[model samples]
Target chain A: MKIAIVGAGALGLYYGAMLQRAGNDVRFLLRRDYQAIRKDGLSVTSPNGDFHLQAVQCALDPAELGPVDLVLVGLKTFANHRLIELVAPLMQDDTCVLTLQNGLGNEELLAKTFGAERVLGGIAFLCSNRGEPGTVHHMGQGRIRLGELSGGFSERATALARMFNQAQVPCEAVDDLRRARWEKLVWNIPFNGLSALTGKNVTELLRHEPSRREIIAIMGEVIAAGNAQDLNTPIEAEIFIEKMISATETMDGYRPSMMIDRLEGHPLELEAIYGVPLTRATACGVEMVRVRMLHALLELGERN
Target chain B: MKIAIVGAGALGLYYGAMLQRAGNDVRFLLRRDYQAIRKDGLSVTSPNGDFHLQAVQCALDPAELGPVDLVLVGLKTFANHRLIELVAPLMQDDTCVLTLQNGLGNEELLAKTFGAERVLGGIAFLCSNRGEPGTVHHMGQGRIRLGELSGGFSERATALARMFNQAQVPCEAVDDLRRARWEKLVWNIPFNGLSALTGKNVTELLRHEPSRREIIAIMGEVIAAGNAQDLNTPIEAEIFIEKMISATETMDGYRPSMMIDRLEGHPLELEAIYGVPLTRATACGVEMVRVRMLHALLELGERN
Candidate 1:
């Protein structure tokens, strides 16, 4: 596959590097990492294994790397305004655009601009961060749930998932993409919002009973909202929440990406992660009060 | 009236000085202000009028103050652990113990220990803070809604109101004390908790529409919880919330006492302000979900 990575942050660099190593034609349209990547190439530090691609296929301008078979978007939702402009030059006639961004509305935005049939939605469970320029640190978990944006199984989705899996990444093709998105949101809305707002890590939040209870309550709200979104299988609030809590506990002292973003003065993925989901839930007549409170607080914090 | 002021913080100092200037014998059982007050009397800077007592009656020990007709408790709710021990030595056979502490359960605790008949509850709208060691800054409002803890108006409550009114402090006797407490909480639980938790003042919070909406929602929850307490008059949520918001807006850049407490590394009145109210609401089958979220966050912030 002749693939193009549009947002060459950690996610883009790491995934593109893997695909490139698998002998697929992968090129990254880079920004801060452009000069360094062209010189020293791309370096990925992973617990799974570390590797350096000495001859990284990189470009500063998207037009220079024009017309790929696939366009993988990893742009921070805060910069969604610049997304279409960046991706336009990377599109071919039959190109598929897959967005592995956090939360909702990414696929819809892309589809609205580039047609619904050409878009794919993927929920990525990747714990990664950027190291020095041209270096991507994959701390843990690199799984992708790839699916058709319009829902149901498709050969294209399956082929895409298989490609990622064969490239040494955990990937699965899901029948219901929206369900997967909402499930991830059930975990994201509370943990990310709380950690970012309070600057408390996972362990510290769970250590306090009241906050822990609130975490569970918010998770339940997200689940309720998710269920109301016409999912194939409604999330079992009790089981899923417990699993998320226990999984978070095992992660040791972990701060979510949103927390890191806030600390580092990067714009948050609030619109994608919070704003979009809130609108969707309310549209479906579901009231997620606690989540709304968290969203409002996070918004207020961002203002400060 | 022979009155002894236990918990001689700013509230106690200002009120005690007012009563003393009214020709009543007022003695304060002091702590940090002991040396300064004893050496140079007490200073009160008020918008009403500034005053300095040349011979302020104060003692380090409650035992030295002896039993008095009235024992005014202006202690922070966090110090309720030491409340009984400190107030015991100063209580007389017919001493009316009036606690002007923030939040619920103060009257109940006093009533449980010192007999219900001897307990009076006063919700003072006093905006005062400690200046120098011997000085109290009466910045804004100083009005007391005095009432018997057991409910309904009484001669003692009226006489106490009359005394405070005669002392140049605005005071009114109320029929239902719990109603007044809850009414104050409808304002306190939101502003106090938000200001303390986020370190945002009233103006900043209200300036943001979402947080302002949340503040109103929490106020409604509190009003519901208050109405559930079988009050003589239920708080009208819409009117009360609007009034509270407008009143808060006029305060310019007002930081609540809890926010100041959190910033100064002082223990918050969490138990009295949140814990007690949450318990009461739950018992009454009125769920204050947003308030609980606020409470939980504040508790977690306190832990940090």
Candidate 2:
């Protein structure tokens, strides 16, 4: 299978490297450093250890890549819109585009750009970041959950999972991907926005009574909003907050991606993580003032 | 008239010097740095001009001062409770202690500590900070509105106003001091908290629509809580937000005192500004989840 990794940041590199080691032809579509990587090598340092793979094909322009079986989209939510447009050259009639980006409404955005059948829901559960141009550093566990947007498990989805599993990456196929996405969204919108705004880490945010109360309140809002939209994913606000708190306690100093964006003065995913959900909730006539306020602050932070 | 300036940081020094220039014997109960000024002199830079008063008496202990006609308590809200005990020696049977601290509940706390008759409700319009131990810098208007906690224009309150006017610090005696205090409380609680939590200047906070809206929401919550307590100071949320936006338009890069405290790692007025108001709202059965959340994050930030 010929696979091209779009927006080849850490997740894309991880997928591309694993797929390549599993006897699939993998190419990385990246920034200017893509060509340099093709000339030098692709590097990955993980918990399993470090290694360099020199045979990985890399390209800055999607036109330079050959016809591919799968194209994994790994751009930030802010970049996913335009990136889907730019990576159109690599998508054939059967070429599947799987989005592993965080936030809500990303899949819909991709489905609008590409056909619904070609867009799959992918969730990467790992702590990784870009080290340098072609190098990716894994901060913790590396596992991915992939499923078709159309609901049923297709042969292609399982084939992709099997290939990923063969390459020393954990991959699982879930019956309903939307539920997983919303469950993650429930955590991301509140925790990310609160932490980024306050500049506090997880334990500090969740351990304090007021902070914990807010997390539960915000999660309740998100869960209610999701259920209101008729999504069957049920989340007890306390349970969700505790899970996030546990995850954060394990990674104490780990700044969420939003915090990193705040420090680097980069545009944040305010629209996807904060804005869209609240907008939907308001349109649905749900009182979501807290999340709405945080969203507005984040939008201002991003704009300024 | 003899006057003692308790906790003589910025406002204390400003009022003390003005009183001294009015031919009153003024003494400062100061910290170690100002204690050194007991041997030196007091210098102040104000909007009108800069001057040094050589005869200004300074004391390291409040007990060292003689019975004063008036005592101006000008410490930050964080130190108000503890500092109340120290200022007792400076007061005689007829002496009044006027509190000009920021945030809500300080006057009430003062009344609880030193009898309501002695505690005046004071709202200062000046922006002054300690330039050094013995030097205070005044910016903008150095005016105050003060009256007895009973909300009457008593002879004592009238005398204090006359003295303040003679001392060159503009002063007013309001018929309803509680309303005035609550009005200022409405402004102080939300803006100060927002600025401190976001590390944003007043203009930056108000100019941004999201922050602007969140601020208005928090202020509305405070006003609701105040009204529930029978303080009939009415404020339209939208109108108040616009007023704040316009007021902050001219003042750029000005950090709120709370923000300064947080940055300098000083003990914050979290209880005075946030905890008290939140507690009030809770008692009134008015929801203030957002304000409580911000306070919780601040508590965490304080710990950090």
DockQ of each: 0.77, 0.59
Chain A vs. true chain A, TM-score per candidate?
Answer: 0.98, 0.92
Residue A282, candidate 2: Cα error in Å is 2.0
- Itemize residue pairs with steric clashes in candidate 1: none
Which CAPRI tier for candidate 1? medium
What is the Å distance of residue A31 in model 1 from its true position? 2.4
Best by lDDT: 1
Error of 1 at B264 (Å): 2.0
* Tens-digit lDDT string for candidate 2 (B119-226): 886888777777776788887677888877877678787878888898888988887786676667677777777777777778888778777777778777776777
TM-score of chain B of 2: 0.92
lDDT of 2 by residue, A152-173 (tens): 6788789878888898889888
Tell me the tens digit of each residue's lDDT in model 1 across A123-182. Answer: 988888999998999999889998999999999999999999999989999999999999
What's every prediction's RMSD, in angstroms? 1.6, 2.7
lDDT of each: 0.91, 0.77
The segments of candidate 1 whose C-alpha lies over 4 angstroms from its true place after superposition are none
The estimated TM-scores of all candidates read: 0.97, 0.92
